[model samples]
Target: VRNNGGGHANHSFFWKVMSPNGGGEPEGALREAIENAFGSFEEFKKQFSEAALGRFGSGWAWLVVSNGNLEILSTPNQDSPLSQGKTPILGIDVWEHAYYLLRQNRRAEYVEAFFNVINWEQVAKNLEDASS
Candidate 1:
């Protein structure tokens, strides 16, 4: 039950927050908020990427909004941040199916590639919605 629901929800959110035309940094208030939350966008990326790679086996890494702040976290198996009442604005699936075809066993490379396709605009919108 947990696996089915979590994977479905996570993948739905994941697809919504990525695009082929995505990449580059976010702008305006979203950028400011991320800077405040993680010091800088680069730092946030580093932390998020690290979290993604740190997950062993099938799992996920999330950038979640909680109490008006952002956090980077990883969940093993099919656990979802929603279980803790935190709102996930962005997430990356580190499961083998997500990257095995292109990145093979190099999870680090897959994590790096995820940044290139992230739809920052959508993510920013999610942040706004979650905050309100």
Candidate 2:
């Protein structure tokens, strides 16, 4: 029951992290923070997208803020970083339901579209809240 609750909560936040009209680069402290933590925005995107695609089964990809740094990670089967002591700044549901309607098995294409719809403002706010 607790695990099911966690999955629903995680998926809820995941939907808001993206929109039809979101994406590009993050701004303000989030941008600077990404640069500092991952070396550059491009690198950050590459790492994040790679992590999203690398997961072998149903799961999520995440950008989490931990110890004042940003990190990319993957969690399988409804697991969330919230359970691991990290704050989730951004999340992408790699579960097939997230993309199967539009992308079928083309996970990479789905990931690319995911980038096109990232709510960076929400991510920045999450990062700020987490940092503080």
Candidate 3:
């Protein structure tokens, strides 16, 4: 069930944190948290994108809250941070299947485009949920 269950949860969470009207810097508490964790929004993007791109195979890049701290990490296959007791605030699927149709192996392009549709509000809610 690890694969199927994790895939379902991961993909479900993935879609939830995206929106047609999304694509802007997060604000409020979430913004401060991000800045504190990664120095700045631009730096966060850079590091997150790098983590996503660095995954060598089908997997996910995640921004997770572990032990009350924000972290950037990658999970292979359909793995979820839940297995490690971490809370995923945001994530991006790095599996080729997620971007092959449009990016055709150019995962970087898809990762970049994903920024344009991120549902920061949902992410903030996730952070709050995780925190509480």
Best candidate, lDDT-wise?
Answer: 3
lDDT of 3: 0.96
What is the C-alpha local distance difference test score of each model?
0.92, 0.89, 0.96
Candidate with top TM-score is: 3
Model 2, 58-119: lDDT tens digits are 99899998777899999998998988888899999988988899889999999988888898
Between candidates 2 and 3, name the one with more favorable TM-score: 3
Rank all candidate structures by their TM-score, best first, as comma-separated numbers: 3, 1, 2
Query: What's each prediction's TM-score?
Result: 0.97, 0.95, 0.98
lDDT tens digits, residues 14-132, model 1?
Answer: 99999999989989888998899899999999999889988988999999998879999999988999999899999999999999998889999888888899999999999999999
Q: In candidate 3, what residue range of length 10 has the lowest lDDT sum? A: 94-103
Total clashing pairs for each candidate: 0, 0, 0
Per-prediction RMSD in angstroms?
0.8, 1.0, 0.6
lDDT of 2: 0.89
